[model samples]
Target: MRIKAYGLVEFTKSGYVKTQAVVLTLTVVLLIFALLWQPTGMWAANPVFGFLEWWVLLVLIAEVAETAIMLLKFKEKEAALR
Candidate 1:
């Protein structure tokens, strides 16, 4: 059978998705690095980098929430078509 899926894997395979994925991965890696580099610090020492860190976290969260909403919408659409 020709199987199909939705969400990030099948629904989004465009250039934007690739760029978003790469940026998301890099942000996560940077977050980990920042945390590791400053085990006790609440924020990065540099104010600008700290702002960037927050922006990355917010973007990551928004991406996750957006993906979940898209998956739910796709499932609803599929069900309606059935």
Candidate 2:
């Protein structure tokens, strides 16, 4: 069940934090605009939809973290056995 960091090593990271920082900045900009728009009395209002979208985003975040952790563990095991 070894998970290889081969691709990462071969491709070169330039580091994860750098790319994640860029993404977080972009997401913040979009969120700010989405939240600041003044209502024209005709704008779509759907709390349920917003809640569902947030829920899905959270699930995706959790799944990504879980997968990364699993891969880390696998790599550790592979290293330990060597």
Candidate 3:
């Protein structure tokens, strides 16, 4: 049996996808570090740790938005091809 797929391969090949993956990984690591370093209510006490956590969250949101846009574009292109 044979199967055909569209858009996914091209989507993965995009440079932005790779960049987003890296950014997501780094943000996750930063989030873990922030949580481990301060397990309790320390955001008010520690500005740097709080800032790091907020920055990681914002980056994650941005990455998700970008990925969604890219996926929509790929879908539109594939539909046009068909």
Candidate 4:
């Protein structure tokens, strides 16, 4: 039997990479919809959704940026290990 070895950083990075990709894709789609959504639109007429749209986008952007920074750091760490 063969066993695979992984570093702590590598494991952490692999976990986050998949999650970040999914979140980023969903965020971009949501951002586009938010940008195109109108306050008067039937679905978005709710004051809460209209008011929160920009905030939601800002939060998502911050999250994605943080994930990107972490990914870059992880890559550097992985490179250093080699």
Highest lDDT scorer: 4
Q: Whole-model Cα lDDT per candidate?
A: 0.60, 0.51, 0.64, 0.69
Give one digit per residue, the lDDT tens place, for model 4 in 1-82: 1112233333466667776788888888887777777666665777767766687688797987787677677777778789
- Model 3 misplaced stretches (Cα beyond 4 Å): 1-18, 38-50
What tens-digit string does per-residue lDDT give for candidate 1 at 4-29? Answer: 24333444334435655786788799
TM-score of each: 0.52, 0.42, 0.58, 0.57
Question: Which window of ten consecutive residues has the lowest lDDT sum in model 4?
Answer: 1-10
RMSD (Cα, Å) of candidate 1? 7.2
* lDDT of model number 2: 0.51
lDDT of candidate 2 over 18-66, digit per residue (tens):
4445755665555565555544543446554445445445655765575
Q: Which pairs clash inside model 3?
A: none
TM-score of candidate 4 to 2 decimals: 0.57
Compute the lDDT for candidate 1: 0.60
Q: List residue ranges in candidate 4 displaced over 4 A.
A: 1-11, 40-48
Model 3 agreement with the true structure over 11-35: per-residue lDDT tens digits: 3436556766887898788877765
| Residue pairs clashing, model 2 | none
Error of 3 at 31 (Å): 1.8
Residue pairs in collision within model 4? none
Leading candidate by TM-score: 3
